[model samples]
Target: MRFISEQRFDNGCLEREFTLGDIPGILWTPSSSPSPLILLGHPGGMNTMYPRLASRARRCAQNGIAAATIELPGRGERPRSAGAERARADLRRALAAGEPVDEIVDRLVIPLVDRAVPEWRSALDALLSLPDVRGPVGYSGGLIALGIRLAVIEPRIAAAGLFAGSFVPRCMFHEARRITIPLHVLLQWDDEANDRQSALDLFDAFGSREKTLHANMGGHMGVPEFAGDDAARFFARHLT
Candidate 1:
């Protein structure tokens, strides 16, 4: 896996191409006048540049939101067979640590996510520093986003969108109430990676005065069902 190339877009934003563990994805700045900064995450074994997150970023940019997706250290341009093996080992450790096999992806992946936050924050700073840029931070996938919400103790986040994500860092659940910013969650009705109960638990935890939960009748990998106008609406409410 490698970063194939980069392209500059309409607003002096750069679009870069990357090869994930298998697939290809683009990291770009939408041509919107004033864009929001979004940090996209992929499901376990999936690429951050996956369409699930890319399409969402594209939509946000089209709707005047500036977005960017950072590839995870081992899964994107720096993929390795050993990386997959390491992920499996982490999963086992998470289970032994009392985290359910199902939740291992959310719990054990924390260290990887912790390592990725600085990269994400740097990317966020670059995107937000652009003129007229002032969008909230949002995330997809499960572990990475929750990790950002947990590990990074910054107050600049205006809003967050967690799609098919979980609630970890047991200590941070109460902080959800303090976020004050609007939060929107998209939970697939038939998810295999993260269960519905987990989503409900997260919803119950976020209890934001302004929160929206959208349900899609699809599996964990099924992303389009949760895309389109609703995503724009979520970013609009939070970013715009």
Candidate 2:
């Protein structure tokens, strides 16, 4: 990982922008050494998502935890894939027409999960090599499908906090059943882009012996501050 630029916050958290091959990413570290790490997940677009990601990272940093996130495939300055674009258009049209979007969601999300999970693992490999970004690692935020795949496959991630404001691919349901780590799923009850029942059923499908769901009444971006506080506490319980 080659760091491009960096800033030091008053709180003693160091934030750095870096690149992994062609993918761009950011890492935030507390002043303290050997801090536990949380991988911050988001929909896409670092410029659009930086405020929330930094907010969440600061929350973790204050608690002596490290945080990091990478741009998803075909987002930001990365080259776009034609298949993913077609899938996205199909998904938008289905959602706009108020038609069932299960198939479209499968097309849109499954490929993304396939492409992103490995990149995340590679990021973890590099991030963990740093002196301060230590385990046990936790993951937080959306896309929930990516979180589920990592929870199932990445043994280093001991817990997860997922934001369920996006469509989940059908095949991920099977993978969800394989996740045995602690999970804290956040759901916005009135999310326009998400199906409430689908979120509920996905929550039910997780095989984690220790799992909880927090549903609040709001839209996708309306996650309350207290929800983030609760998520930080959840990670602290498992990772700290």
Candidate 3:
């Protein structure tokens, strides 16, 4: 990792921006010592500087946990893939036409998951190599399909804070059954982009006995601030 710039917050947290190969990322750590790391995944279209991501990272830092986020494939400085564009166009059309959710899942969600999971794993490897980071890593944020795949395949993640506002691919239900880490899934009940039943189905499919659901009655953008607090607490408990 090559350092780009850094700033120190009044709360004694240091936020450093860096580049890993072609990917842009940021790491927030307590100024005093190394802490457990949380790999934050941003919602699609948002990069490492997204308000929620930065806010959550600062929150984790305040709680003595390190937080890091890397740009996803086709995002930030990474070159966009033609396949990703095609899949996104298909998803937009399907959602606009009120097409069946399953078709959208098959056409877009699965392809995105296949492209993103490997990138996430690679980013995790780079983040863990940093001197100020420690084990007992946790994952937070969404693009729920990516979370599902990571939870199922990445044994390094001890817990996850998954946002369920995105489409849940049909194949992911089986993968969800394989996730055994502690999970805290947040859902917006009235989200227009998500199939409510599908979200419930995905959450129900998680095999982790320690999973908890925090559902609120609002639109996709209405996730309350308290939900973030709860997620920070969840990560602190598990990752710490």
Candidate 4:
């Protein structure tokens, strides 16, 4: 309803703070009915207000849902934290001090995946603190989305909407299977992040009673206007 305010939460290692929008986002309910929330996480190079995310936020607002957009550390106004690059280097070193096969994927294989969960949880917490906040919430994006889903499986999040992302299903599959939340996945025909097969793999792994897969005929950023409306409809059915 009103611009609550914005605050910065550190990644625990960085002095530069990450910004979160608490005001002027999408809000459909009266801020008391416990509606589902939509939290956005941008790609490494993008921010919360990018066209794709902004458009969806507006649509969600029009449809009577609250929407918040988020940015990862160093991607928005901040730069990489001191020793962030070095910490990544150390993780690589630790992972490398093992067998050759495991060493190849090594540090990035798990630590990076492991680190993202908390960030999403923190963002969700911030979004839910508003007046009419509700239980079921969802996320969209690449590693950020996958990592968050991997961490917590709350049935309150009655549904999830994913676009162009997947995770290590083998390691995350058991937890992933626990997700009874309906899933709506969107993928571009020419997505370089793998292919439609990647989205299919995630969908099949989830085994939700309800699921929808859409293949749009566009490049990475060319999601149709219909997708936003579809997302609103899906969340409304499950969240409300």
How big is the positional error of residue 186 in model 4, measured in Å on the Cα after superposition? 1.1
Please give, for residues 15-70, the per-residue lDDT of candidate 1 as tens digits: 66655444454565666556566666554433533555555666666666665555
Which lDDT values do the candidates have, in the order given?
A: 0.59, 0.91, 0.82, 0.53
Per-residue lDDT of model 4, residues 98-212, tens digit only: 4232232333334544544555555666657755666566655545245335424533345677775433434554555656667777777786444466456666766667878
- Lowest summed lDDT across 10 adjacent residues in model 4 is found at 8-17
* Tens-digit lDDT track of model 2 for 1-240: 999999999999999999999899999999997899999999888889999899999999999999999999987778898998898899888889999888888888888889999999999999999888778999998889899999999999999999988888878899999999999999999998888999999999999999999998769878888888888899989998
lDDT of 3 by residue, 129-221 (tens): 878887678888777778888888999999999999877778779999999999999999898877788888888999999999999877888
Alpha-carbon runs more than 4 Å astray in model 3: none
Q: Cα deviation in Å at residue 54, candidate 2?
A: 0.8
For each candidate in turn, give its C-alpha RMSD to the true structure in angstroms.
Answer: 5.5, 0.9, 1.8, 8.3
lDDT-best of 1 and 3: 3
Residue pairs that clash (backbone atoms under 3 angstroms), model 2: none
Q: Which candidate number would show the highest TM-score if scored against the true structure?
A: 2
- lDDT top scorer: 2
What ranking of all candidate models by lDDT puts the best one first?
2, 3, 1, 4
> For model 3, where is the 10-residue window of minimal lDDT?
41-50
Could you give the candidate ranking by TM-score, starting with the highest?
Answer: 2, 3, 1, 4
